[model samples]
Target: MENKSKPKYKLILDAAVEVIAENGYHHSQVSKIAKKAGVADGTIYLYFKNKEDILVSLFEEKMGQFVSKIKDEIEQIDEADQKLYKLIEMHFQQLSEDPDLAIVTQLELRQSNKRLRLKINEVLKGYLTLMDDILHEGMKDGTFQDQLNVKLVRQVLFGTLDEVVTNWVMKEQRYNLVKQAKEVHYLIYNGLRKHN
Candidate 1:
């Protein structure tokens, strides 16, 4: 594998996001990605084994940065509720800022085969675990309901954000996605709060 720390690796990955977003996963070719990256086609092979590897690596690299940023932002907040709100807000904000990435992640990547899907899921675990950490913190601090099921709540929370973003992408992003973060946070926060 090529050294991931190299600038060319990131170039190819970013280019893959663009190519795949425009041409789709099945139609996106290494040559196209390489051209978009301004690298020779052989350069991609040095970094990735195949097109499938590129897709998986793209998800891993991007999602790693995604989760890391969210984690860093949320770590400064003392309240779990605010942390969760930041999570939702950042999720919408990041995707909204990069329409190509939103299209690649929310649409193109989903079209991959089952094996690739599973690999993508593996990369998602870090983000899911971050959510779980927030949920557990809320429960421990008496913010969220004590009876909350962490796993199920995590799934619901992820699904809510995922579906909302997917819908926004599907709708051609005519509306501002980040604008909905407040209501989404409100609904989720109210649902998870401890009852009086």
Candidate 2:
């Protein structure tokens, strides 16, 4: 198994986030990240194939943490609506709490090459799968219309959240991103609700 929490790996991951966040993805160098992590430059190659690999791994590691958190949080809630609200809240709160992460994810990640984008997308399937679970649950319980297109709804839900976060990142995060969680939940709820 890949040991993400090993001290050196964790240090390299954290240092990569800081380095990429401060320098932007293109300007970020492996040597700089190694220097920040107090490791030899070759240490990065041991964990990742290249700079692109580091960026992809950073996203995988960060998003994987949030996905795990969301899964744990969602498991406690019975209602699909409640689960969706928690999801939105956690999504916003995580990015809001870490401004550097917000920059790295929303801004720097978008500037990556095509191969990197695909790799990131592959890692993102887990988050999308989680969203699909909520949509399926809603339909099962009659909270959402049975005839609703789950794939499209997934896009709407994911796209709406992505757009909102991107806008916040672009504005330099001057306002509360997490504060929009409730309203975002409401809007998405209305869109998927059977009775709406």
Each prediction's TM-score versus the true structure: 0.98, 0.95
Instruction: Indicate which candidate wins on lDDT.
Output: 1
Error of 2 at 58 (Å): 0.9
Global local distance difference test of model 1: 0.95
lDDT string for model 1 (34-138, tens) is 999999999899999999999999899999999999999998999999999999999999999999999999998888899999999999999999999999999
Itemize residue pairs with steric clashes in candidate 2: none
lDDT by residue (tens digit), candidate 2, 1-196? 2466678887988898889889998899999999999999987777888888788888998999989999999999999999999999999999998888988999899898888899999999999999999999999999988998899999999999999999998898999999999999999999788884
Q: lDDT, candidate 1, residue 19?
A: 94
Q: List the residue pairs that clash in candidate 1.
A: none
Measured with C-alpha atoms, the lDDT of residue 153 in candidate 2 is 92
Model 2: number of backbone collisions: 0
- In model 1, what is the error at residue 3, expressed in angstroms? 0.4
